[model samples]
Target: MPAPQRSNPAYRAIARLVRPVMMLVTRRDWHGAEHLPRDGGFIAVANHMTNVDPLTFAHFLYDNGVAPKVLAKSSLFAVPVLGRLLRASGQIPVFRNSARAGESLVAAEAALADGECVAVFPEGTFTGDPDLWPMLAKTGVARLALTTRAPVVPIAQWGPQDLLGRYGKVPRLVPPKRITVVAGPPVDLTDLYGRPLDAVTLRTATDRIMGAVTRQLAAIRGEEPPATPWDPRRAGRA
Candidate 1:
């Protein structure tokens, strides 16, 4: 299911144009970018704080010598002009409720094999916890890291939440807030490589990854970490 590494013309064009605009519009800042693997495919796992977070992450990675293919919600690709643009820019559409989870994983692995960075939101939704800390994440991201042997980067985003709150859906062109994207170092879950791919291990790894994200978010937000119940264990039905 992995995508080929052939040049994505549309992505190239968009990145070429968007980087400068992003820089001019916001004082975009990044940290721990050195943690990004210089020459291979990896999974960039981040919390979904706002709609604009994806573009910010994409532009940051692209500027830092890594262009990421995003795992976007399938519905966004249904829009008219935006959908066409997203498709051209090499974004991967995922049907959240469909049985196609495995198919998405395949595409992610392919992109990693080709040395492209694939960005994923482990939480799968915008943060609803008023505090902006990471909630429990899904196991799809862990599955990708294990299967593709890709370095998993933990991204902690701030400022984007201010531009558009969780309910904003999208950012307003004349919005009052500026957005910022911060990339943390890549996390290596290679230790779990040989572990059985069962519910227990998957959930454990997922929690560990989210724990990293939570730490980063806590630092960025300058607030004490949210209480443990912020992300309680869910029944395993997958």
Candidate 2:
């Protein structure tokens, strides 16, 4: 097995504090660590089910030898202690729907070039699917993968929602939930690599990435996803 990446002091400190709490509140059933790239930078994409899943996802990657630099929402970097820790730990902030929105992409690209693991939730937020399956995702991940020519690893996780419901104010930690996280092989975007970054191309690439994630989630849940992934924008129009 590949050795775990060496994290910065701030990240290590934050992980030391968070990992124990996670262990106390959750049982981990992680698989497919072998699929993660042992040395080079890669984009780790996962389905977002609840607010807490990011922590579980990070735990899985960190435990498996990758120190993930997640692209988080800009608002998260504004909180008090959490904000300071996030900045200190080198987490990237995403300014959504603003002129600064593209900044996160640039940072992520640079991180990838430096051979760091960059984690992204392409759906951009928790899945709006009533069934908690992955929804249609934004194409930012596609852009990054193509631009950097980095491998895109698809991860699917189940059980974080049980510990903390999608919109719940309180966590259900009476009996620690079992968090099952599995990684699939790097998404096959080789054919689309040299293509132009147009709308159709981006959407095509995004669909393949999300499909891989949904398939992994389906295997974990032993259930089938919808024929058409839910689209928040389309639902809003209705």
Candidate 3:
């Protein structure tokens, strides 16, 4: 077997602290780890289910030998100790709806070039679908993948919602939840490569990426996803 990916001292330190807590809170059913690149940078894209899914997602990747540098909200970087750890661990802060928003992509591109796994929750927030299915996502992930030509690995996870609901502030820890996370092969964007990054092109690529994620989730859930993904704007929830 190939050696595991090495994390920086800071990331390793943080992982030591987080891993045990993750173990206490959840049981893991991870699959398709072979799909992860044994080396080099790649984008790990997953569906957004709840607030705590990020922890579970990171747990999967970290245990599989890759240290994930997530693109997180800017406000998270302002929180006390968390902010310092985020910076030290090299997590990218996304400045949303501002001139600096693009900065996150630039940083992510650089990280990929440096051979770091960059994890992205393409849904951008909790699934707006009442069924907890992945909703239509923004095209930023597609844009990043196309621009960088980095491999995009589609992952699906379930069960984090049991720990923390969509809007619940309290976590239920009595029964440790089973967090099932599965990764599929890198999305096939080769055909779309070199295409103009126009609206049509971007949306096409975005749908394919999101479709891959949704399909993985469907396999895990043993159910079919909606023919059309939920759109908050169309549902009057945006």
Candidate 4:
């Protein structure tokens, strides 16, 4: 099967601009690449470590086989040049807390139906966990994965947060960071995929997806994940 290609000129343009720059400062070690389907639709769900990781994650996905279309915060699409790049590159902007947030899902469904890989960061934003562990995730990822019946592939990424802090900081490039992205087999949502999209099912499926990613991280981080994943509300971190 052929690798997924981008037809959007803006995507092509960004690829020309960013790919070379990325290769210069990042060394990629990707595992379980076989889990990435060569063709068709699927949702690649990953933990949020650093905002910059998305760029490199996109690079990893594009290099392996598929081009990822992500659901990003609306604010990102309102910026000047960067916004234009995001929009022109076929990204879906999410209008939050208004009447239009639902449109992001609609756009993502359309992309998935069209055989595109839709990448979702279930943690929604950067993990508030001080240790950089993934916090409790949003359920939209489960909804999207089940609604479209697409494989919910779990991937864990490490090393990007070291290079870039949540708030803008001088990025460290010397000694070029080793960014490792590992993909585990798709989370076993088959039992829950066709079930009613009730809160229980959605939450359960979301946990499984997060669990898979955590497992991957545990293996890579050489540590044990918390017995219960960090919950912002319970921990008063919300």
- Pull out the clashing pairs in model 1: 1-106, 1-107, 2-106, 2-110
Please estimate how well model 2 matches the true structure, expressed as its whole-model Cα lDDT.
0.92
TM-score of each: 0.86, 0.96, 0.96, 0.94
lDDT of each: 0.75, 0.92, 0.91, 0.84
- Candidate 1's displacement at residue 97, Å, is 1.0
Query: Sorted by TM-score, highest first, which candidate order results?
Result: 2, 3, 4, 1
- Cα error of candidate 3 at position 26, Å: 0.7
Query: Which of the predicted structures, 1 or 4, would earn the higher TM-score when compared with the native?
Result: 4
Model 1 scores a C-alpha lDDT of 0.75
lDDT (0-100) at residue 116 of candidate 2?
Answer: 93
Write model 1 residue lDDT over 1-238, tens digit each, in one string: 1122433778777766776666665656578778888778888888887877887777667767776889999899999987998888778888888887567778888888988889999888876565677777788888888777788888887787666667776555453445545567766587899899899878878888887887887887777876662443442212
Candidate 3 collision pairs: none
Which parts of model 1 are misplaced by more than 4 Å? 1-7, 169-180, 229-238
* Candidates 1 and 2, the one with greater TM-score: 2
Scored against the true structure, residue 2 in model 2 reaches a CA lDDT of: 38
Lowest summed lDDT across 10 adjacent residues in model 3 is found at 1-10
Candidate 2 global TM-score: 0.96
- Least well predicted 10-residue stretch by lDDT in candidate 2: 1-10
